[model samples]
Structures are given as C-alpha cells and as structure tokens.
Target: MKLPVLYTFRRCPYAMRARISMYYSKISYEHREILLKERPKKLYQLSPKGTVPVLNLPDGKVIDESLDIMKWSVSVNDPDSWYVNNIDHQLEIISINDKEFKKWLDRYKYHDRYPEYSVEYYRGKCEKILDNFEKILDSEKFLFSNNISLSDIALLPFVRQFSNVDIIWFRNRFINLSGWMDELIGMDIFQAMMKKFEIWNPFGKGEEVIFNN
Candidate 1:
C-alpha cells in the first residue's frame, strides 16, 4: 500500500508533536527521517521551505505544517477523541504556544545568540507561560480536564523542550506542571513516537520505514 509519507526530524518539537499525534491516532505512514542540514531533494520538491514533519499524501496533497499534519492524522482516526471538546479554546492555546511561547523558548534555549538579554530574562518570559500552565494543571490533570486533549498533545512537546533547557530549574519550580509532563512523557505512545530511525537516503534503494508498525 502507498501510505502517506512523513518527512520528520526526530528532535524537532514540531515534528515530535506530529509524530506523537499520529501515533496516538494509530495512523500508519511511511517515515522519512531527515537531517535538517542535509535534507533530501524530494523534501524541497514537496515543500519549497523544506521544513520537517511534512506529510505528502498519496493523492498528491502536501501538508508542510506540523500542526496541520497532527490535525489530519486525528481526522483520519481519533480513537481517544483528541480533537474533540472545546476545539476553539484548544486551538487558541496551541496558537499561543506556537507563536508566543516558542519565541521565548528559542531565546531561552540559545541565550548566547541574543546577548542583549541574560538567560534568566528569557527564562522568565518562558516561565510566565509555564506558570499559567502550572495553574491550569493544578486544577486538572490535563490542560482541558482529566482526559488528555488536542491542546495537551500540541503543547507538551514544546514544554518538554522548555524543561530540557534547565530541567533542574523546571523541576524545582513547577510541581504540577512537572507531574503533568512526566505523565505525558511516560506514556507508551510517547516512547513509540520517539523511536529512532536511520536517516532516509533517497539515493539508495528507497527503503520503507513504516511509522508505528
């Protein structure tokens, strides 16, 4: 069968979330692990910008954005209702995470790039978002409620990125948020989503790596 092709970088938070959502939805696809520096020619052919987590459907539709890939995956088969309930609010929170929080996270992670501000200042900006999440998690197990939803999966990868920057500081600061992250990260689907794959070689025999097979 000609499954949808997924061009992904293992460590990118955007790609990670896409993979996680696809795994949760149990949608089978061809996984093409790519290096950002040495991206395959096919990726650029499919997407001019050549970003990771680009899904090329067998029907010739291309979805380059990670969030859109996630939505498409769940739309195919959402057994856990990840896309349901308070969709507008969930999408709003995801937008904030992708736009506002990610900016500070990048600055915080690579503080030396922006020497105008100290690392702490950038972290402080990220913490404001974390603090809001902490308050929400304190009230409920997940972002929306006890059950995991689209918002939780959409934002968890970025939160994981934030915690990785300074895990000690993150663990020391947010108890509720830490537990929430731990719960999501410890899930079986997360482990499957993180399974490593050899870099795809378009020039080689074109080996098919089935995602979550």
Candidate 2:
C-alpha cells in the first residue's frame, strides 16, 4: 500500500523540522524532494501557496504549514514524549522562534537585500533572543526540561542556521547554546532526516524516498 507523501526541500529549516518530527515519530511516508524554483504541478494542485514539507495524507488531506506537520506527526505517534510537557510554554517558545527571531535571522543571512542595516546590526538583533536561549541551556539540558520536547525540536533548526552564519563567532560566544545544539544535531534522527535525495519528478513514476527511524 502507498503511504502518505511528504514534499520537502532539504535546506529549509521549516522543512527540516517537519522531516525531523516525522522521522522521530517513526512515521512511514513517501518523501518528494522538490526544488523551490521549479515546483511540481501536483504540489501546486494540492497547495496553491506551494511550500516545502507539505504532507498529503493517504485520505487526501493536505497539511502545508511546517508546524502543523510536526504537530500531526507527534499527534499520531510521539515515541519520545515530545508532547508530554507544559504545552503552553512549548507553543510560546515556538511562536517566538517562528516569528520574531526568524525575522532577525532572515535579515542577518541576507543583509545585502535588507541593506538598511549592517549584517552586524541584524546579528545583534538576533542576540536578544539568543541570550535567552543561552540562559535556558545554561540551566537545563533541553528548553523546558532535561528530556527532549516539541520546543527543542522546533527551535534548534533556526538556531543551527544562525550558528552557521558566523561559525567562529557563534562558537566563541555561545558555549552553552552550542553544546546543547551539538548534542541534538549529533543524534541518529537528525542524521537520518538530513540524508540527501534526488529531486522528485512526478511524471517519471520514480521510486519514492522513504524516511524511517
């Protein structure tokens, strides 16, 4: 029997999170690696707003939002107890991650486009939130507690992107945050989710990429 199809772009942090959730939950799905510039016609038919990490359920339902995809993945099977926590705080942290910090991240990564400020200025803007995350890691193994949770998975990819922007500076300044992030990134699940796949062509009826635990 055919499983659900998951459309994803390997480099997108949002898509990374969605893939991480599904992989960690041990959900079976057909992975469709799509190029952002040349999206598949089937994807546009399912979601006009066309984005990566779009999951088409076997029942014909489509989930486009990355966070929604993560929630649905864990809802179906949370093997690591990712949802067993203070739901409110988890949601609050992820909200800030996806909204406010992401703004600074975009500006920092593409400071040339947003030439209103120096790249340093945008990097400084991001530190406001990074400082808080640093403090969190200073005390706990994960965001809310020692064990992994939804908030940790949701926020790490963005932080990873930030660290990559200035690796030397990030390594020098964010000792605690780096350590916390390193442990998560080093895990088997992260490695598996990051495996490369060829760009999918719907018309070819090619073999599907299957992600598993």
Candidate 3:
C-alpha cells in the first residue's frame, strides 16, 4: 500500500496533535516538515488554505483539518477505542480548546500582535480553560477516564503551548493542571511526536520522518 504523506510543522499545536494521533495509531507515513513562510507549492495546491498537518492519502483524498486527520489516523488502529465512547463530550471540549481557548492563547502568547488587551486579560481568559482541565483531573487521571482518550491527546498540545507562554506563571496558576501537563509531555508518544525534522524542500527529495508506534 502506498503510504500517506503528512505535512507538518514541529512547533504548531495542531500539527503536534496530528503527529501524536498518528503515532498512537501506528500509522506509518512520510512526514514532511514545512515552514510557515516557505511552504511547499504542492502543499498549497493540495490544501489551498495551506495549513500544516495536512494529510494526503494514498486514495488521493486530502484531510486539511487537524481534527479530521486525528480521526482518520485513529480509525486505522484504535486499540484503546479512543473514538468509540464519549464522542460528543470529546468534540465539545476539543471545540472549546480549538476555538475559545486558542483565541485567548494566541493573544496571550503574542500580546504585541494583539495590543488591544493587556497580557493579564488574555492570560485570565486562557486560565478558564486550565480551570476546566483541572476540574476534570481532580477526579480522573486523564480526561474522560483513567486511561488516555481522544480528549487527553487532542487537548494536551494546546495546553502545552499555553503552559510555555509563561512557564513560571502557568506552573503557579494550577497545580493539578501543571502536574497533568508534566505527565503528558513526558510520555513516549509526546517525545517521539516532537522529534525534530529538517525543513522540506519541494525542489529536492527531503528525508521522511515516520510516525510509527
């Protein structure tokens, strides 16, 4: 079978989630690392919106959204049944993480770009997301259950970006959330997914990074 090709950017939270899901599902593919400023022409042609984490399937289908790519990869081999139960809840939280939380996260991370608000204001907004995660972790080790699920894997990358915005401030804000972040980021899956790759050059054959469990 022809392996799918995945275009990714290492530090992007969305791309991180896609790589984690593909790794967890043991989906082998040719990983192409791209730069936001110097994206490959094929990537733009395939996904006009031109976001990273785009998956070009062997069947010629293209999945441009990170969530869709996660579902596609997990469906291939879900030993943990990551998507079978609590799907509605999973989607609900993931949506909030992607939409509302991400809005505040960007503002907080790049306060200079969105100068309308103070850093504290944006930080406060994102803290609500951390509050929600802390409440969930108070009862369970992972979101949705004791074991890792779609919610845990899907949400962690964004939370990681939020945490890195001001590590000292973040660590002080939510103890439970901080512990949870430490645990998830320390996992083998996270480590493997975050391995560095050279920037892709469409003019030449770039090395492929495989995301196999």
Candidate 4:
C-alpha cells in the first residue's frame, strides 16, 4: 500500500531538504502542495506542530520536523549506506549543520532582526563553517563519505540558503566549493524535484503529483 502522503511547501528550506532526501531515497509519496499562509486542515490535523514537510506515515504516524523526516526516509531507503554505514561521521556533520551552521545562517540571512549583529559578524560565523567544509570538500565529494551521503544531503538546503544571502560574495569566495553543489543539484532527481508547482488545487485520490519520481 502507498504511504500516507507528504504535505510540502515548495520554497521552504526545510521542505527543500525533505524533498531532496526523498528524491535520493527513491521514496515516492502523494505530494500535497500547501501554501504556508493557508495550511490545509488535513496537514494541520496530521501535524499540529504545524510545519511544512510533514510526513503522514502508513500507520498514521507523523513526522513534522525536516531533519527527522530526512532521518526517517534515509533509514528506510538508503540505510546501511548513505547514513547507516558510517554512523558517527554522519552524526557529527548533522550536529554542525543544525547547530553552528544554522545559527549563523539565520543571523546572516536576517541581520536586520539582530540589530546588534553586523552582517560581517554573522557572515564570519557562517564563513567559518564553509572554511571547515572547504578543507573536506577540497578532498572529497561529500563531507561524510566520498559520495553523497546523508550528511551532504542534510546540510545542503541550509547551505544553499546561507550562500544566497550574499550570492556575489559566496560565489567569489567559494569557487572551490561550487563543484560540491553542482554535483548534488546536477542530479536528475534533484532537478525534477525542485520544480515549482502552483498553489493548492487539491488533487483527487490517485491524482497525487509525485514530482516525476
């Protein structure tokens, strides 16, 4: 039987991370495109934590967090490889991605909110993460393993968001890391999954748009 669907908002960094991981995992689901400003009752019911990228599992279980969704999907589809193979390494990268990188990313993206924080201060914090990554990326294709592992997949959406906050600066400063991104987004799965869809036009049963998977 098909799993109970995924409700996603296309442009959300959290949703983007979930979708990309789903793509990599070869997991397909009913894709309900939701408008964040007007989240559907079905999604609100599934996860009153009320976040985008909510996954309604077959047994009526729900996972509302993006990182949790990535872990769940990878555990099922890419287990013993992308994530499960090198457990400790996979964990360490996720720790930095969620904690250090995300903190700096948020501050950098919304420096206006943190009036006491200068863009340089936040950018410096974010740059430090990138610099650490550059050392690894300079040698391997991904952070955890040579191939695209859960660590790479998990950190990417946030990194993409963080870089875009100052595109020119990022592009110039991180020329070496361009290939790392190019390799991930270059996948047919990633490209096909990221396509923009129109607002809620709720599809009928069996009419779910599965993003070409």
Of candidate 1, the 10-residue stretch with the lowest lDDT total is: 204-213
**Top model by lDDT, which number?**
2
List the pairs of residues colliding in candidate 1: none
Instruction: State the lDDT of candidate 2 residue by residue for 104-158, as single tens digits.
Output: 9999999999999999999998998999988988889988889999889999899
Error of 4 at 81 (Å): 2.4
| Model 2 stretches with alpha carbons more than 4 Å out | 206-213
Clashes of 2: 0
Cα-based lDDT for every prediction: 0.89, 0.90, 0.87, 0.79
Where model 4 places Cα greater than 4 Å from the true spot, the runs are 201-213
Across residues 144-213, which tens digit of lDDT does each residue of candidate 4 receive?
Answer: 6677777787777887887688778887888756678778878886787787766656545422544334
Model 3, span 1-213: residue lDDT tens? 478889999989999999999888888888788999888889999999998889999899999999999999888989888888899999999999998999999899899999898999999998877798889889988888887888788889888888887889888887888888788889898898888988877776545555535
Deviation from native of the Cα of residue 9 in model 2, angstroms: 0.5
In candidate 1, what are the lDDT values of residues 1-213, reduced to their tens digit?
A: 888889999999999999898888887788889999999999999999988889999999999999899899889888888888999999999999999999999999999999999999999999998898899887899999999998899899999989988799899998998999999999999998898888888975333545453
What TM-score would each prediction reach against the true structure?
0.96, 0.96, 0.95, 0.88
Candidates sorted by lDDT, descending order?
Answer: 2, 1, 3, 4
